[model samples]
Target: MRSAVVAASLAAVALGITGPAQAAPARTSAATAAAAVTSTAGGSITRSEIIERAQYWVDQGVPYSQSAYYRDPQGRTYRTDCSGMVSMSWHLTTSATTWTLPDYSTQLGSLDDLQPGDALNNVNTHVVLFVGWTDSSHSTATIMEEARPGTNARKTTYSRSYLNSNGFKPYRYDKVVESPVTVPDKGMTNVTAVGDLSGDGVGDVIAVEAATGDLYRYNGPDYVGRSARVKIGYGWDSMSDIVGVGDITGDGVADILAVDAENGNLYRYSGPDYGGRSARVQIGTGWDSMTNLTGVGDITGDGSPDLIAVEKSTGDLYRYSGPDYAGRTARVKIGSGWNIYTSLTGIGDITGDGVADILAVDTETGNLYRYSGPNYNGGTRVQIGTGWDSMTNLTGVGDITGDRVPDLLAVKASTQDLYRYSGPSFPGGSAVQIGSGW
Candidate 1:
């Protein structure tokens, strides 16, 4: 009963958000204002007081040594699961709060309707507190919670894919909320197309060819040879990895960010125009900067697009703010154990705190790390998936399973296997495997 409702609700969100309702807010300046509003809310603690409090608490370190886990009915530590950790945190923060919890099956709903304190359920497996979501498509989100198995209390990040895996089945919260879309797209396929094009906020099939310099976008509904092809860059070559979708240049339309393996050039394009070429520029200097770059999205709080590039040989990350494509702004180093073979994928909000955070996946080693903010000169980094299995592909950003904040969707790719992490709300650490083995 619980699963059936979550699947239906998310499918409805796909249809509604992508429909005509996503049009401009009656004015161009209004759109920019909307962007600003969205960006402002990206930070988890809105006020300096809360930010200071959070930092102060974290600086003191997780006080697990002084605390003991709440024993479940089975005598197991509730801290063993993600939701249990969150529940424990809530208890510690407020003397009034109790271990008695609400059923996650009923808490899922439109993200817009949720409050900061509300808890959202992810396919009934995990949970996280409500944090702000991105203005457009709510593609970006933030959550603060403890993550992983057999580990002490730690904050983690979650993305759209975490919830929407398995044909959006993983997210089953409440009944579908209805909002009429005003946009004139045909037969709901545009939602699928936009997903293919990279920024529609859902998990779709996308592939880029380095040899032919071609970009292919396909929907899960009909993935064959047919795909939207755009020739954004040149130099007779191969493309390696890609990340992010948005108006990187503050333009109203969405754009693409890709990396060229050979020259180490980071390219951005307005569109892939066959007649001519779209506006493209090379960002960053230095060896590893250009060699491997991944989009990190508005990291500097400047509202411009940002990129996190890793040196193929050193694994060091260079944060390049992109308002100035010509200069690529400032570069801040990230991560200590960087490796060339490691693949970095962007997750919305891992910490449950609203600020923009990123998830790094080590392709070679299959380890996962959640980076929260570029704060304190370099921000805070937490290692999550340092285990045997690694995750591939972030499906989308949303409360797929209905936890207040967005969760993440990951696929192994090799076997087309799907896995999910319920936000802090559903902390069982029991990753529910969905879909067929690819």
Candidate 2:
């Protein structure tokens, strides 16, 4: 966001001038993991898409300099400085200075108001695209910026102390549209919003009472606790591994899948009509040897939602092709040595990759790791949190709070209390106890 003078300084830096160095986010390569974004100017942008757009420049290794302008893939031109970089990322019609950028954004009161793809601006000094708070304590921030002359557009973490040392103010662009996950009272039922069971856009919780064996659907207000729940089925106490895989029956309505406790057989519960579930239909047999069962949405890139199972004996992971409605197909092995994890659950597409990701808790380290789709190769994990040794169950119940990120439910081993970790929060995770007597 610096002006002509800063541009000149950048030019000098490019021409062999330099200053105190700063570090960029650690990476195995300069290459980016996010896919490229193809967008035109002028329209609402989602937070994930904004990050994708910003990543384009980072992928290109666009250098920081004002003397020359940068042209985006959409053929838009903007200054090569920090603000110009933000302009391109936001897909602004034209480059806006730091002072003028405020015109298109709302100033936030505190760091907690921050979201990915927002901005932190110190007018006339600099502007950086706010990626997100690096930790739950709001102690550090991750940002993408054209940091002065000679430096390339980069992403790195900075301490809150340093960011607040300047006159930085948080701002969210007016046209920014968050992901479907919005917050409190946004159709979140008081009970867990596990997955959409009522064919509504908002996810509905399908919970089985431990003693009564009654399956209840919680739909209506957002988040867990006070939502209205209706008994949908009886005798679910004998079933384990309940999951709401997206529309697997090709019936246009989402269906619930569960494993019968007596047998390892998995059954699909497609509705009798559109309103209520039908009798259990066996789809897969001999699943009793599976250590984990998860219905990951469309992981195969096909229209059908797929499920993954970890072999109880070998610690191997296999994907069951969806539309396997008739019966289980030859399950495909996607990853091996999964037994090292104490738990694994399907988190609906945390990355904007169209395929759902898996969350695994390492048995030895108790580390929680998220593996982005399309496959779970061994080394692909990025550790998101640790100290999860006592977790008895982990369910990623899509997005509940509408934070443009997914929410997770973890049942504690010692207390059986249910804890919720709202989206995009990890490391310094914010675990809010949402329920008890799970």
Candidate 3:
């Protein structure tokens, strides 16, 4: 049931570009290309956005050319071949050929598993979007694609049998959810902590200006230049007070949890941005005893943000599961002797076991250690590296490489230079300098 145009397009493309085509002179440099076609819109896109983008290509009445590339009104460029069309629809980082597209996707078992925004890709030749099912059997589907050279983009019906016969496989883009970004510094000095404040899965920096006791939030490193500063709150005058950032409410937006050094009280703040906070909900009364307070991420597996705190005097570690820290007895003692550590932060699933892990810097040596856990019960620990003593500040950043594993961001104390270090378990090696001068 494959449309004649789609079949012909496959044949035409197979005879066309066999590898990445040399981008035309007018095309933007690959490094400067947007992460997705609709990067401006921000956050994970809706299924409707995918469909609308595909429809926009059709509405443009762009005649297919093997080497034709179209720049949308928003300035994203799209090639007009089959994989190009799918790449544009998915807002891929760049134009990828059918053979290379699978590298950016997680393979699906069958056409029946396809979703509205999923793809039907014939490895090496053609790719199309699965809009919906035309039949309950899931054997036939409504697909959209740029047909062939000289043809216009169109929606057509295709049978699973026909697609499978042609070597078509199904895949979902690995970035179906937007990866976390790094927050740029905009006069952000003394960055005490970092977290995803905008809840876009990108990590923003939290800085306390010692001069004014004012706290500010900067959009993570996804933007081109220095991110604009958004003042979240005031009266955080002390640098000693601890701050933990995570989506505590499970609302998909990052929130703030802080321990006021003035009073030893823990507070949670709601966020879309940091401008306004919810009424202060005191999680604990005597936070002054807590040291190395950090967000450990669902340590209890309860689907809510769990916090880790070390007893200042004893170095005893405790995991506090929360509805909002109100339950007085929610604390579970996880380990002891944490006082030997100078810094601790969640590295976010570094073990690749689907559970968030903890990273601690040894106080005596500045060595970095990764602790794997089901719930921070002193689980297996491994030393990832040493020489972290040079870092003045360190915190868990959400995914920066788009590999789905969260990375570590550090600020060199002496230079204030920013560097992103990949999880040892991820694809890349350690440390890419992200910015200079803090």
Candidate 4:
């Protein structure tokens, strides 16, 4: 009898309970659509994309069909149920019911926290995408949902009181592609590092296949739809050993800097783009003790890119200004206890003060910290955000928001979803989903 009860519960959870009949309204206001596009800092799907997809349904006069599924322009199939419409808008790998969507979302405490790409969900029943707030008090919001059977997918306004009374819970999807433009990885996996390799102003992604020691680069954010794969010597299985990538040569184009995992030797490779025959220049040895590595821009005010490294044992941070191996200055001790950091990156001019800042994520708590000044020495340490432990990798991806201040790009370890955090600082800031499915 217990086994039967368990099975029944599982079934109930799979097929969520139906909610109130959806009101088939017209498209949302232009301001609401515009807000959706610009409100989120970074995501694979912008508010505009969501509005566009939802609008496509409206234009097609797509009637809600539990038995039939809607096919996206990419030829992906999704059920026409309420949850299915959300799944399609979210670009999820597969359709999910209301009960299962919370598993892929971060719960928001109140409707006041709602953003364009966020969602309203009642775990037992219905789900809706939040487009924008309808009133100054945020008591009412404009939303898009499939509504109910026999109804066409449409946008409608709902009062917060009505939604809360019906058990609707606000949530932000874990995988948000704030920007629709993306470069699909051509069978690449285990992205160890990312940077702007092509000097195109847009950041690119780097991946290393451990089994093969093969390195691949993909133009990102504004994906040009191509990749360049090359073998970087051999025996490079340790992802942590590979360090920074930037314009190390003082050239306009970016370069790749890596530490030999086995020998602790640092090497720099010059070639702004792929398909160019380039050779590696060994910088120095004794990098085996380095726990973390980052490219600090012109710490010495020199034209070339400088470097920062952390010692694994002592949590000591060092700044190395360079012109290549012998020309590089002696290591300058900058900070200590850096070993407690799981991820570190040099965010360019985060304060908009004409100086670069260092961003670090705590290993234990996932709390984010910013070290701001001309250099790491005597810089102020400010706590940015907590609960970033889900991040597997974090790096500075230039000024993604076009705000002059640099932003951060992060990858979730479990879902491999990409996120971007923008603003003058991370404190009181939020990350929007930029890419999904690794």
Tell me the tens digit of each residue's lDDT in model 1 across 152-216. Answer: 33222233333333111212222222222121111100011112234543434344332233344
Compared to the true structure, candidate 1 yields what TM-score? 0.43
What's the TM for model 2? 0.52
Regions more than 4 Å wrong, model 1: 1-205, 209-214, 219-237, 271-292, 325-329, 362-365, 375-379, 386-390, 394-404, 418-438
lDDT of candidate model 2 versus the reference: 0.61
Model 4 misplaced stretches (Cα beyond 4 Å): 1-201, 210-212, 222-240, 273-278, 325-329, 377-379, 426-430
In candidate 3, what are the lDDT values of residues 222-259, reduced to their tens digit? 32223566777776553243455566677765666666
lDDT of each: 0.37, 0.61, 0.58, 0.57
In model 1, state the lDDT of residue 165: 30
What lDDT tens digits, residue by residue, belong to model 2 across residues 1-438? 000000000011111111111223533222235334545587777777677667667656688787788777666788889899888888899889898999888999897899888899999688988876423335446677787764576654443544554567899999988774221111111122344546566665666554355666656223354345576667665665566566666655566666665776877777422222256677778765664567676655666777777765666788877766333357888898776665567766555555566777764455677787778788878777655544445666666665656667665432345666654433324566766555
Alpha carbon lDDT at 353, candidate 4: 54
Worst 10 residues of 3 by lDDT: 1-10
Per-residue lDDT tens digits of candidate 4, residues 109-193?
Answer: 8788877767899877778888765333343356777766545666544545446556788888776655543211212233433
* C-alpha RMSD by candidate, in order: 21.9, 22.0, 24.3, 19.6
User: What ranges in model 3 sit over 4 Å off?
Assistant: 1-201, 222-227, 239-242, 275-278, 326-328, 375-379, 425-429
| Local lDDT at 40 for model 4 | 27
